[model samples]
Target: MKFKITHITTYLFDSEVFLEPHYLRFRPSQTSYVNVSELALTILPQPAGHKMVQDEDNNSVDFCWFEGMTSQLTIKAESVLETKPYNPFNFLIYPQNFNTLPFQYNVLQKKLLFSALEVVPISKVLSDYALSILQRSNFNTIPYLTNLTKQLHDDFSVEYRADGAPFIPDETFQLKRGSCRDLSWMLINVLRQQGLAARFVSGYYYFDMVKPAYELHAWVDVYLPGIGWFGLDPSHGILTGNTHFPIASSAHYEHTMPVSGGIRGSASSKLNTELIIEKL
Candidate 1:
């Protein structure tokens, strides 16, 4: 499948303020299953300096620094890409002994995935909730992940929150509803609780529709020895496939934000975003 996507973000400040250097993670990541044929990024009040670079997580970033004061800032990104279809579950788990739930990674794997494996203190309710899914899946790793993703999707209501940090896992669990990032973050903690190395992923999700409005999507990526990093979307209760175009991923969600920077003045700001995804 081929796609054309346009995403625009604008910030309006009450007064002119010095624009600080910003990191933009808008370029679609080129992966084994996805090809990026074309991509363009536009910034208003033309930046004084700009460079395209890769971050520690291997995400493409547009680093821009501005020199003048401005009352508003605008960024627009456009891309055309093609994705290959493949079975999301085509791979096998490595080291057969690690195919079950509550299994630990080997020494080398553990050292590399240390950050992703760091567990946050979760409430008993959340732990019990994850354990219930584990038991239901008969302590099988694949089934446990599938059931956990499906259960989260079925039991929680998805809310459209354009901005804000993710809510804590326990809070989201108690509320039974959250934005995609909140759910993904919750899922990451849940996986960590089970001794799995999971990280936060931010990207674009293409649903088959007629020029539908879209937003940046969030999901979880679990590291398995043999298959490497695999994506699971609790928001949709499905394994991520070709339609999932990742921009950035990190052990912490904040690091994966599409835009990160600050201003030099205390001017209040209003943010607006528009996204369009079309299938070609």
Candidate 2:
């Protein structure tokens, strides 16, 4: 199916700022089954503003604001393309084992290949809840994993906000909930703790009974050797499927962030962002 995707992000601040550095992952990626066209980012930088690819292999931006008087970072992205995603329910191609997958431990021990997970530390001790998410042997234990893989036309909540990092493994276990990226990253770390190879995913997803219309999102996909990487969203308690156009992934959310960079002068400034994602 062909999908027209449009994502816009606007930032507002309290007063005139010196620097407004930011990364722009607003650009739709050209993946195996997705194509990107008509992509651009406009920043209100004081002296000059430009964007660059943070990682070409995974498709992320290391954007920044050199010098600016304004206090806003606006990013707009749109594209026309078709998607041929792989389904996980009916096919049941491979079962997840996590016991033996590449980079199961010391996730960054390899070539230091950066991914969504690499940004976050997944090597820490595991909590009961995060560990339980991976310990499930019987797929039947997963509340909605089987059914929702194909259940579409349902409403979903698309949240857009940023903040300081949350307590890992500990807090996530009690709530069994978090932002989209948190859910994705938490699960990825959980799987890693149990010797299962997992990675972080960044993209967009429909909340619940809400519309699929969303800005940016995060999830996880674990390698099961035979079946390859299968996606799961512990937050929503569902498996990611065809409609989920993956932008990029890593061992942690920080690595898979849509944007990341440092500013020159704007150190302690309140950053406000308005994100509008529409499906046309």
Candidate 3:
């Protein structure tokens, strides 16, 4: 499938402010599943300088610096890409030893996946909740993961939070309501509590069947030995495949934020974002 995506973000400040450097991760990532044929990014007031850099996670970032002070800032990004369908079960089961409910990683594996394996401590309530679901899956790894995803979609109330930082995993789990990022974080923490390595994924989800059309989405990816990385979307209760165009993936949601920067002047600001994705 091919898609044309346009994203515009505007910030209106109460007073004129000097905009500093901003990191933009709006470029679609290149992977085995997708190809980016064309991309364009425009910053109004015209930035002084801009360049693209790859982060440690290999995510492409546009680093742009501003030279003038302005009360409003606007950023527009457009891209055209082709995506290929991916089989969630295409990889072979991890070749390593696997005899238990919670898979154990050896010393080398643990060392290599240190960043993704690092997880905040989960509460007893959350642990028990995950445990109950695992038991229902008879401690099977894949089924447990997918079942957990399905349960999250069926159980929690989804709030569209386009602004503000995502709630921590505990907060979301206790409230049982959050944005896509919150749900993805909760799923990542829960899987980590069970010794699974998971990470955060930030991207666009093309939902041609939905009213809003398409929008930014968040999901989680779990690492299996032979299978590598498998993505699961708890908000939609589906395994990620074609139509999921990722801009960034990281262990921290804050790191994957598409646009992040600071202003030199202290002034209140209002943020507005618009996204349009259509099949081409």
- Give me the overall lDDT of model 3: 0.87
The candidate that wins on TM-score is: 1
Task: Assess every candidate by TM-score.
Answer: 0.98, 0.68, 0.95
Lowest lDDT sum, 10 consecutive residues, model 2, at 149-158
* Count of steric clashes across candidates, in order: 0, 22, 0
| Local accuracy of candidate 3 as per-residue lDDT tens digits, 167-226 | 888899889899999999999988887788899999998875757645688999988877
lDDT of 1 by residue, 222-265 (tens): 99878889899999999999999999999989889988999999
Task: Give a tens-digit lDDT track for model 2, residues 199-231.
Answer: 777776533336443456666776543555577
Candidate 3: list runs displaced more than 4 Å.
96-100
TM for candidate 1 is 0.98
Looking at model 1, the pairs that clash are none
Q: Rate the local accuracy (lDDT) of all candidates.
A: 0.92, 0.52, 0.87
Best by lDDT: 1
